[model samples]
Target: MPVLTLNADNRKELAAAIADERWVVACLCAAWCGTCGSYRATFEELASRHPDKLFVWIDIEDHADVVGDLDVENFPTLLIQHENLVAFFGTTLPDAGVAHRLITAQTELSAAQLAAQADSSEERRDWQHDCNLRTLLGA
Candidate 1:
């Protein structure tokens, strides 16, 4: 899919999409920044490659309230959100190869981390149940 020009119109739908486990790559930029303008094409190319991930180009000044909640301090801030958690953030945009690598690594790591958490929770529950059984049997 093409990079989405995020405005007030589709903001809620975008948030809902992200909340629904869809990965979103939000580029927080300002219209005044030359670099932001320059990277528009590159960003679009990246978005095109990853159709499953929603790519949103947000003009910081135009949407200060929403960007403020993101705690963006720089002009061309790249925030990658997978599901509800922010997977990556910072001013890493000069090298496209590095950016791609970082995003993919984060996505995989987040998946692994979540899976591990679920496994741990299941183990804890099983242990607790075993302990309860032991207590009932006076062991």
Candidate 2:
């Protein structure tokens, strides 16, 4: 699947994906970031490889309402979720290989493992409430 850029028209599609419990791999970036612009193609290619997952590109400055209260500290922050659990949320290197590895590792975890890991750390537990795209987007 191609990367879905979050916008007013397609917000519901992303919302539905989250509500339906699909594994959503979202890249939160800003329009003005040069790294984000250059990395878009790489992100798209990553999407193509994982057709089972929903890939979303969220331009933070454009969708402040949807991304409210979530401070993205850097460009190309990746948010990976399955069901209601946020499997991983953090800034990643622009390298597609690194992303591929990370996605592979996270997606390989069973639901129970994911849930346990989500609660394993303060930051990760906080991600469950703070960084969920479903909650943030009001899905």
Candidate 3:
């Protein structure tokens, strides 16, 4: 499936997908970043490969309300979630293979494993509290 760009038009669909507990892979980028522009095609290709997961492209500057106060310090930051548990939230290399591997690795974890890992470290715990898209999107 193609990557869905977050906007007013499809915000409901994205919200519903998150509400349904589907695995969501979101790419957070800024419109003005050259790296983000170049990585857009790669993100799309990653989405095409992961048909089972919902892929969303979010421009932080354009959708500040949706993003809220999430500190996205780098371009192409990714937030991967299943239900309310944020499995991973951080910056990644722009390489498609790196992202592909990350998505695969995260998806392989069972729900219990994911939950355990969510609090396994201070950083991951912060992701659980601060980086939840469901909360950010008000879904």
Candidate 4:
């Protein structure tokens, strides 16, 4: 699927995406970021390769109410989730190949492994409560 530009009009769709088994790869960025603008096409191409996943382009400045507290520290930060598990959340290098590898690795894991990671450390545990897009978007 193509990248979904998150906003009020289609939050319901985001909600359904969140509720699915498919991975939610959200690129948390800002409209003014030069790197983000250039990387948009690469992100969309990456999404096409994984049709079952839901890729969201969230301009943090525009949707601050939804992602404000997610502590996005860099442009093109990727928030990856599956079911209730926040598999990964942090700054990602702009290289689409690197993203491909990361997403593949995360998605290849079984559900038990993901749930274990969610409880493996304090930070990981916090991700379930804090950084989950489902919780943030209430979707």
Candidate 5:
């Protein structure tokens, strides 16, 4: 799926949508930015890989008011949110491999938290193993 476009009009809904979700990745970008345009395809691919997670693409120019509070200084910036909390930001869009690794890491971390919340020991253990293996493999 294409990255969901966010703006002042739907900022509240976007926040509410991601509030209880395990993970969300928001891309702060502008339409005229070449880098942002280039990264869109990869971002969409990642979003497709993890449909459960909210992938928001915000056009900084179009939604300056909403993003003004963020004080973002660069284009194509990435922010990873875990349960409505910003867990990571300023991660660069270097390449698809790097993007995949970052998304996988954040998703695994969020999954661990979700597993804990559900009180599923088996699920938690499985996530832990998955994380450990990913780390060991340098993914």
Candidate 6:
């Protein structure tokens, strides 16, 4: 599937589509960043390759309310989630190949393993409570 750009027009569809996904990959970026502009195509390519996963292009500046309380410090930051558990959340290089591998690795984890990781450490536990897109955006 194509990348879903979350804006006022399509936000509802994106939220609904995410209901059946095993994982969600959200690229948090800003419209004005040149790096973000360049990374857009790569993100789309990744989305095409991973049709089962929901890929959301969130322009932080445009969707601040949706991103509430989350501090995205750099361009192309990725928030990977499985259900309400945030498996991974951080900045990454703007390379589809790298993201492809990361996504594959993340998807391979069993549900039990993912749950363990989400509470294995204090930081990880915080991720479970804080970084969930469902909680963050009420979707």
Q: What is candidate 4's lDDT per residue for 31-104, written digit by digit as tens?
A: 89999998899899999988989999999999988877888888789988998899998899999999999999
lDDT of 6 by residue, 86-105 (tens): 99888899998999999898
Q: Which candidate leads in TM-score?
A: 2
lDDT of 5 by residue, 4-91 (tens): 7875476666666665644777787889988889888878988888787778887877876555545456766777656533445664
RMSD of each: 12.8, 0.9, 1.1, 1.0, 10.6, 1.3
Local accuracy of candidate 3 as per-residue lDDT tens digits, 8-34: 788888777778757999999998999
Give residue 70's error in model 2 in angstroms: 1.2
lDDT of 5 at 10: 65
Off by over 4 Å in 6: none
TM-score against truth, every candidate? 0.73, 0.96, 0.95, 0.95, 0.69, 0.93
- Tell how far residue 37 is off in model 2, in angstroms: 0.2
Residue range with the least summed lDDT across 10 consecutive positions in model 6: 13-22
- Model 5 clash pairs? none
- Candidates in order have lDDT scores of 0.63, 0.90, 0.91, 0.89, 0.63, 0.86
Residue-level lDDT for 65 in candidate 5: 51
- Model 3 scores a TM of 0.95
**Candidate 5 global TM-score:** 0.69
Q: What is the lDDT of residue 130 in candidate 3?
A: 90
Considering TM-score, where higher is better, how would the candidates rank from best to worst? 2, 4, 3, 6, 1, 5
Predict model 6's lDDT versus the native.
0.86
Clashes in predicted model 5: 0
Give the winner by lDDT: 3 or 5: 3
